[model samples]
Target chain A: MLEAAGTPQEIEGRSLWRDARIRLFRNKAAVGSMIILGIITLMAIFAPMLSPFEYDQIDWGYIQEGPNWENGHIFGTDGNGRDLFIRILYGARVSLAVGLLATSVSLVIGVTYGAVAGYFGGKIDTIMMRFVDVLYSLPFMFFVIMLMVVFGRNIFLIFIALGAVEWLTMARIVRGQTLSIRRREFIEAAHATGVSNFKIIFRHVIPNVLGPVIVYMTLTIPQVILTESFLSFLGLGVQEPLTSWGVLISEGAKVIEASTWMLIYPATFLALTLFCFNFIGDGLRDALDPKDR
Target chain B: MNAIGKKKAVPILSVRDLKVHFTLSGTGLFGKERKLKAVDGINFDLFPGETLGIVGESGCGKSTLGRAILQLIPPTDGQVIWLGRDIVGAPHSAMQPLRRDLQIIFQDPLASLNPRMTIGEIIAEPLVTHKADLGKEEIKARVKRMMARVGLLPQMINRYPHEFSGGQCQRIGIARAMILEPKLIICDEPVSALDVSIQAQIVNLLQELQREFDLSLIFISHDLSIVRHICHRILVLYLGNVMELADRDSIYAAPKHPYTKALISAVPIPDPEIERNKERIVLTGDLPSPTNPPSGCVFRTRCPFAKDVCATDIPTVDTINDHHQVACHFHERM
Candidate 1:
């Protein structure tokens, strides 16, 4: 079938992947979100270098100070006199880290579990899905609380807990996607070639199902970030010294009357980060979608 | 009928009493487990470098038989000897090396090629997976060569599958299958999804490639005319059982089995005058489900010529000539 498409030399004129990327870029909202996301990611990475005030540094003199542009406290100080701008910048590091890291962990576990269950089918699929259903029935807050109680409130534990819970939805999505993709001719063709089951699942099967997986992963990041923020708001996340956006929001909400700036700064940053991630995920959902092509 | 002259050379692939049964839980309230015999005791031999066509109506176990031979689906009981190796029950790990020799072309070309992957990547995947020793440049060169062989533009290697038409997609599918130089290719209705003109093109291409590669083909299709054009030998299956097996000419000119005869008569000839005059032998009743097939002969329920004896015992292949075999009680009278 490859021969009829014309020669490799002829294929050099234009590539499909490039064309897809071009079409994706033309989606102004997606592209714009991607750029903003890229900038935010860079800022998060260079938080230490960019922030003059250490995340833990406190100044009693500048307590509850509003955005003072000349003094270089661009977003002003929190109730603890910590630079809100610097804290939020550093807070991005933790929020993005937890979101990305947890999502990655979920993706690996989810895609593998889903592919195997969907590909093998029959009894294996039923059993795996039933397990997922059991997990799904458990309340999200209860599950997280149970994990925190069992594993303690370390950063790693938070990542593990969020990832473990998030994978259920991802597994369901991946399994559904795999069910449809496994029925495709290429998979059968791969089977006919005597390709190893492992290779078939990982190489051929996973790549085809990556579209939905990627879209789900994008959406999943926000969910994880929100969950982490909620946990931190309830005083169970990030501990005292190492603060996340959730920690900042939690602290800010306590001093809303005396220092509205504290509440507004962290809340705006949190909302913006969530909006950016959602926009990026939505863009990717459309871009990577085979139906759109 | 000179059976002695051809008896010495063993067929490249032989399937003996192949049965692929799926245990389906009853949909009713009871949820009783019932064995659905998808491929029921089918037997055939594929000669080296011969295109053995399996022609049957939909849900007649033709595709199931193809998959069973490849060990894509585990057979309940059977011996699929490919060059003396029983592949029916062979473990997937043990069957890995044998995969390079056996490949398949699927019916839906569009669905067969991965949409996300470029044509080049899709074709190179098998080579990369199996032949790991080959370097990047060598793989690219081989992919380009294989692409050329399938009549695809080599430059279009970077193009995704959706960019191509149905014929183009089928070509890509053919390229992927033939890239590794597999000896036995199971073409599961490869051209049935294509237009009439494209079907002829694909069939011709398959025939040319088969001769060039000296490959044996298990061509599965419901299109009798297309099967007649490509296959050297034909196997007629009905309700997961072999109804007839013969050389193409013998099957077309003189089909002994009533089922085979009915199937052939149903094919509409291109010529209007002959097509109008031709008597169509439409079989009575729907196809019996493989879950609970009729006793004795599976075709007895629908066979117009069936008698009491026909429903009592399963008909074995009765040799009509050196290469022609039919599974019908009245073959002698026919």
Candidate 2:
């Protein structure tokens, strides 16, 4: 028999989450994106303190001005004479909030629904998954519009509307993952121990499925952000004085031929944020893959 | 305990005509419904402190039998009477307390321990669940004691299962199962996945633990030699049906069933001369598909002494002696 190694191997303690974090940091692109994302978040929180003018403050004399160093409007002014820089900064707060809040709502609902359906796995699974299938066939945008019309054009309601629609795919992903995880021997061992089904789903099943869920979350954030942009572009999201990146870009599009900086600034930030999210999502997928180890 | 005294003691567990048939998905919408009789109408009794070895080929339902007995998977039909209570149809709430008394060890040790949990947490789970009143200090003390008892170092408690070797992982699995001090533990090929040298170590650890706890074990394995080392009663299964069941001494000394004889002959003798001289009775074909087993007797198609009558009627188990039973039509002449 092999004796316990004389050296007692130095790797005596390490967790999957810890190791995954290490791997994630090692990817230069992921780290770079993380830094960019951090900077964007800070700028969004400190926008009011940092900007010289309020996002809605209009200087009628400086209307449609372009990149003037003298007046300190670095990126220039919009058609409404509002400082474009502050508008883009304020827009980020709404866009990021919508992305994060809606995605989180979807996360909780998806993981719970999927874990229950997958772990119990019988007539319950059949019924629950079929329900997801039915929802999948509905026109999601139309449903969101209906919700907006019924509930009024509140921004928080938009969070719920998008979250309620987006969770279908998350449920499908988590359910597929949970279906395989429920068959694993640890799950069987948990069942043998008489751990209540609810406890087992959360403790054993959900933790095992988190790798996929997390990777999918990064990807889903960008999708949620884009969906919010689409809603705002359609004039249904974040009304007038409260600006979003989508609202700025839509406002900029009208004067793209006359003045280019209006469309250029907000669109650049939106594209950069979306690109960073995709990079981080790709990095997480590779890092969490068991085959990589 | 004397053999006679042990026989007179009330059985700790009794399985009566347990059937676990799974319906297979049909190929086409109109394809006929098919049943795979994974564990077809099997019965056995387990006594306290005795290791009942269930030996069979792969796909012969040995694992299914173990799971069915523990009610991990609901059996299709029959009774799993534990201490006189029929648990076959027991509700999950009713089965919770019973699960504390009946535990299980699995085939793959690493796969059986959750990768996300520390070894300490994995072993303490049963205590936290069933012995909810146990204080943190008490739970830690018990977990540390169990880790040492299974030959794992107490200091290694915080590590995840992936950091351990296969043998050490199996030790963790053993520690987890034994922590609850269960009355019965169904070991489903616990050592089959380990190296030969490691297999002996695990088997010895299990035996030592069994003696200390007076554990009643349903030791399932396809390896006959390993089963011979730890099992008190030997049950030879073929295609989900019992071919022979007898005490180790009787079954090894004089196997009555033809299937039992063939299985015993396959065990390679240690001595060179005896190994060279012994005759081997290798079965001719692969195990018949459970979905379409041979008519009447499941094993008739593979039996060396098969006859027309063997194909027409299922053979009932015949009592050769008080301690031995053979399920074959012509066991007397065999």
Could you give candidate 1's fraction of true interface contacts? 0.74
lDDT for A83 (candidate 2): 93
Most lDDT-accurate candidate:
2
> TM-score of model 1, chain A?
0.91
Residue-level error in angstroms, candidate 1, position B179: 2.8
Off by over 4 Å in 1: A1-10, A13-20, A42-57, A70-74, A122-153, A290-293, B1-8
Question: Candidate 2 residues A1-293, lDDT tens each?
Answer: 23652344333589998898999999999999999999999999999998799999998889999989789788899988999999999999999999999999999999899888887889999999999999888997888888888988889988988898778888988899999988899989989998988789888999999999999999989898998998899998898899999988888898899999999999999999999999999899888985864
Q: What DockQ values do the models have?
A: 0.50, 0.51
**Candidate 2 whole-model C-alpha lDDT, 0 to 1:** 0.90
Chain B, per-candidate TM-score: 0.96, 0.98
User: Over the stretch A246-282, how does candidate 1's per-residue lDDT look in tens digits?
Assistant: 9998988888887788888778878877887787777
Model 1 accuracy (lDDT, Cα): 0.85
Which lDDT values do the candidates have, in the order given? 0.85, 0.90
Worst 10 residues of 1 chain B by lDDT: B1-10
